[model samples]
Target chain A: MDWPTFIQSISNAVILGSIYATVAVGLALAFGVMQMANFAHGEFFMAGAYVVYVFYAIGGMPFPAAVLSAFPIVAALGIVTERFIFRPTRGNVLAGFMATAGVAFVLQVIVGQVWGVGLMRSVPTPYMGAAEILGAKVSWQRLLILPATVTMVGGLWFFLHKVRLGKGLRACAQDVEAASLQGININKMTALSMAISGGFAGIAGALMAPINAVTPYMGHSIIVTAFIVVIVGGMASIEGSILAAFILGFIHTFVTTIFDAVLATMVGVAFMAVILVVKPSGLLGRARV
Target chain B: MKYLAALAGLAGFILLPHFIGEYYVEIMILFMINLILASSFRLITTVGDWSLSHIVFMGVGAYTTALLAKYLGWPFWGTVLIGGMASAAVGLAVVFPLLRTKGFGFFIGSFALGEFIRLIWVKFHFPFGGPRGMIGIPSIELGDIDFYEATPYYYLVFIFTVLCQVVLYRIDLSRTGRVLKAIYADEDLSKCIGINVARYRAMAFSVSAFFAGIAGVLLAHRLGAIDPKNFDVNTMVYLVIWVVVGGVGTFWGPIIGVAIMMVIGEAARPLAEWRPLLFGGILIVFLTLLPGGLENLILRFKEMLEKLRSAGESQPAE
Candidate 1:
């Protein structure tokens, strides 16, 4: 590949990695805190995109404002899911996880019914300029994702390390009984974790809405990618998720550049499978007893 | 009494198509195909590993038969057998690496592998027809019987369903099935007892995939066309919903689940775009409130009836 193309690919990889981190981080958080693995996380991401579509595209709200709004909207969805779906099925982790598939279906149908499922909804890009970095030209909209991800992930790190409630969530993840005994409400922590998970996924979707086609079933492909990221990152390790997400993003982009999207996805899955065999706990995940 | 109910149900299945319209007969065929799919899925779950690839295995079978029959002009019976074997082989390969993890890890890993296999079909247009899928698949031809007719096809599926169910039921009742159940109940304990946990788990997965392939074969011929989209994760999730809603604890649970859901599905035809929402709602309800599924409800009802009978008998004695 030429220098310009290589630079372009590297920039694209960064953008892809940012999006994957944003989507997978919440999944890792939710799983860490509550063992509540959401199968509908992609749907949550899709809902976030639709939030941007409905607010910025249709309602004529400012793009940044609409994107910001996805956090609360999808976070509320996460909380509701935790209460109704995750809470009741908590004892059986698999059941709780699988039930989210039902949630995914419900969300897809609801969104499809309301917004019309036949064609993809195109959210017009508000930032419509390209920037020259090195020799490669990258879109401003795509570059915006890098700072947004860094800020969100950085802010999350601060919250988990500094904030009392975030510490409670971490404690709950480490030992539910101990955390509960120590006066942490497990329910609240789980809910909070899910909220953050939803919020992160939502913002990722909102940012991508203008770039990706908006569809009800769009969650299908993304959920697969998120699951791969979560598994490869170490099922419950937030740092691992971020690292794996970028690694997968690079793998996906470079492989796609070399071959095709289908082969790239296949390569991604193969990479995940190999990782699973070598380090089942993930690249940086601690082994669970 | 159980034998009598089974006989009557069998008789009803044989005669129903004669009375119903051709469209309904076709629906019944699809229902039976799903019955095989769900029951085989329950087989894997007996080992406590719920695969998201069972439907994809069906796709494997369909595509296998589609390629062989279309290109090589293989006969129906030969294609079906090969399809089952092909799916089992693929299932073994997929489950091989998955042996390292359990629960959530296995679930996600299987999905990735399943998607990988599916993308192969989507990526290759030379033989698999890419995303558009294959059409003009030749219908079954056996001994001068017009297999294209609804009745013949229904009977064909019925025979396969009964045969598959009987074998699966026998397996469930067999020692192998017990060992699988033991693995699910306590893996460590099963290992201590000299059970080859990995071997049995692999066996169950392959067998399940084998049956799923058969269902796919039946479906491919019925539709006379196959698409990559037909075997996607959405279909797999629907299978999960069936097994979950029906409860895979017993051999008959998935059968009952498939029957009830199929009926609900047919009845909800008027709902059209809203149908998936209702089914999704049912899945959530069953998982949250009735996690043991309708089978648990039936078992509870049976226990309640027995309690009522004993209570009446004691009252009379008193």
Candidate 2:
């Protein structure tokens, strides 16, 4: 490949990796704290994209405002889901899975009903120009995602490390009974985790709305990819999830560019199989009894 | 009395094709095939481990049967047996390494493994017919009688379903079944008591895979096509739902679950747009209200009836 084309591929890989990281980090958080895999997580991301699509495309609201609006809306939905669904299904893994799976299907059907499932929604790009950096062309819209993701992830890191409530959240994730004994409300921590996680997914969806086709079934592929990333990383590990997401993102993007999407998917799945065969617990996962 | 009930049920099943219409007969055959799938899924769950890739075993069987029959010109029946054995062999080879991991690790591991197999199906078109899927699968034939019609296929499916159920029923009541139950209750304790937990779990999975393969072969013949999309995650999810809704621990639970689900699916066909939403709602309601599943409800009701009978006997004068 030429230098410029190679640079473009790298840029695409980085952008895609950032989105994957954003989407998966929330799932890692929820799994870490609750020991439940939120199967409807990608739906939250889809909902966020729709939020932006409705506000900006249909209502003519500014893109930035629509993006900002999705965070709170999706976060509220997350809290409600935690309170109603996850709380009741506590300690019942199968129930939680079924409930989430049901939620995913419900959300998809609702979206399909609202927006006709025939054609994909087109979200207009807020920034339409491209930048030339050392003979490599990068679209402003694509570049914006990098900074937005960095800010969100950085803020999340700060919240988890530097804040008291964040420390309680971590403590609760580590040991619910002990954290409760120490006066940390397990319910509140769980709600908080879901809120943050859902908001992150929504924002990721909002950012990608311009670049990718927005459809109800979009979550299907996204969730599967997230599952693969989460497993390749240690489940419940935020750092591990981010690292794995980028690794997979690069692998998928680079392969797709060189070969075809079908072959790329095959290669990615093969990589996961080989990893499972070798490590089993995953690269960074600690053995849990 | 039990023997009489079994004989009557068998006779009814055998004579079903004569009374039902062709379309209805097809549905019943599909139900029989699904029963095998769901029962095998339950068998695997006996070891306290649930696999999302259970349907992939079906895919393995379907693809194996389709390819061998199409390319090698093998007899349909021979291919069916070969396909099932192939699935069993693959199950045995992977079960040891897979069962070594537990919890969500095993769950995700099997899922990836399944997807990997599917990718191979899509990538290697020469052998497995890629994304377009293989079509025009030859139908099974008996001596001087082609089983191409609905009646013959229905009878074939009914016989296999009964045979599979009989085998599974025997296994469920055997010494190995007892060991599997013990492992499910307390794996560490079962190991301490000299039960080979891993070996038994692998055995259960292999048996489950074997039946699943048989079901797959039947499904391929019924549809006359096999595609990569047939064994995707969505199909796997539905299979898991069938097992869960039917009651994982009960042998007959999945039978009831699959029958109900298939009926619901057919009934919901008119509601095309709203069907998925309705299906999701049903799942949620079942999860919240009937968490132990339909079988549990029946068991509880039976227990209540027994208690009422005893109470009436005790109150003699009243």
Candidate 3:
């Protein structure tokens, strides 16, 4: 590959990694806190994109504001899911995940019904130009993703380490009974995990709306990759998700560039399968009883 | 009395396609196919691992027969058995690496692995046709009877269903069934008792895939075409909903679940767009409110009736 093309692919990989991290961190958090894996997480991402589409594209609101709006909107959806589905199905991870699948179906249908599932919604690119960086012409919109992801992921890290509630989620993830014994409100922690999970996934989706085709079933492609990321990262490790996301992002981008998207996905899944077989606990994940 | 009930029910089912019209008969055939798929799924759950790939195995079976019959001029009966074996081989490959993890990891791993296989079809346009899928698959031709006719196809599916159900039922009733149940109940204890957990898990998966492949053979012939989209995660979710809504505890649960849901499915056919939402709602309700499923309700009602009968018997004796 030419140096410019190689540099461009690297930029693409970085942008993709940022998006994957943003989408996967919440999944790790939710899985960590309450053992709840939201199969509807990709739907939450799709909903975020739709939120941006409805507000910025259709309503002609400011693009930044529409993207900001996705966080709370999809976060609320996440909390509602936690309240109804996860809470009732708590302690049984499999059942809870399966039920979230129903949530996935409902969200897809509702979105399809409202938006008309026939064609992908085209959100006009609010940022239209490209930026030259390191001899590579990267689109300004794609360039923006790296900073946004760093900010969001950095903010999340600061909160988890410094904030009181964030520590409580960590506490709960470590030992539910012990955390409860320490006077932590398990419900609050779980709700918090899901809220953040939904919000981050939403932001990722909202940001990508213009770049990708927006459809109700768009979640199908993403959810598979997200699950692969989560599994490879370690089921409940936040940092592991971040690491795995970038690794997978590189794998996916380069492989896709080299061969094709289908083969890249096949390679990604195979990579995950290998990780699963080798280290069931994941790359950085500590084994839990 | 039990024998008479069984015989009469069998006769009624055999004569069902004669009375029903072509469309409903077709639906019944699809229903039987799903029954086999769902029951095979339940078999995997017995070992405490739920696979998201049973339908893909069925797809493998379908593709096998489709390709074999389309090009190789293989007959229906011969290809059906070969389909099962092919699926079983694929099942082992899927489950072997998966043996390292248990519970949720295994579940997601199986899904990833299954998606990998499905993607192979999507990625490849050769022998396995691409996304548009294969069409004009030759119909099943048995001696003296063209199975393309609805009645003949119905009877064909009926025999497959009955045969598969009987074999699966026997497996569930055998000592092997007891061992599988024990594995689910207490894996640690079962291992302590000399039960080979890993071997049984793999065995259960392959066996389940074998039947799933058989269903695939039935479906491929019935549809007279096959596509990669026919076996995907969306279809897997429906299978999960069926087994979950049916409850996986008993032999009758999936059958009962498929029957009730299929009825709702057919009746709500006019509202094509909203059907997924409806089924999705039902799944949430059953998973949340009736986790054990309709089968649990039936079992509880049966227990209540038994209690009342015993109470009446004691009162009369006194």
Top DockQ prediction, candidate number: 1
The DockQ assigned to candidate 2 is: 0.58
Model 2 lDDT at residue A87: 85
Model 1 segments beyond 4 Å from truth? none
Q: For residues A251-273, could you state the per-residue lDDT of candidate 2 as single tens digits?
A: 98889988888877777766776
DockQ for every model comes to 0.73, 0.58, 0.72
Q: For residues A1-289, could you state the per-residue lDDT of candidate 3 as single tens digits?
A: 8899899899899999999999999899999998998999999999999999999999999999999999999999999999999999998988899999999999999999998999889999999999998999989888889999999999999999999988998899899999999999999889989999999999999999999899998887888889889889898998999999999999999999889998999999999999999999988788630
Model 2, span B105-211: residue lDDT tens: 66766777778778888888787788888998888876977788888888788878888999998998899887888998999999998998888988998888899
List lDDT for all candidates, in order: 0.92, 0.84, 0.92
Report the CAPRI category for model 2: medium
Docking class of 3: medium
Candidate 3, chain B, TM-score (2 decimals): 0.97
Cα lDDT of model 3 by residue, B1-318, tens digit: 999998998999898988888999999999999999999899999889988778899999999999899989999889999999999999999999999988888888898899899888888888788777778889987688998899888888888899999999999999999899999999999999999999999999999999999999999988998898899989999999888888999999999999998999999999899889998899999988888999998999999999999999899788
How would the candidate models be sorted by lDDT, starting from the highest? 1, 3, 2
Q: Residue A110 lDDT in model 2? A: 95
Model 1 residue B308 lDDT score: 97
Model 3: DockQ vs. true structure:
0.72
Whole-model lDDT for model 2 versus the true structure? 0.84
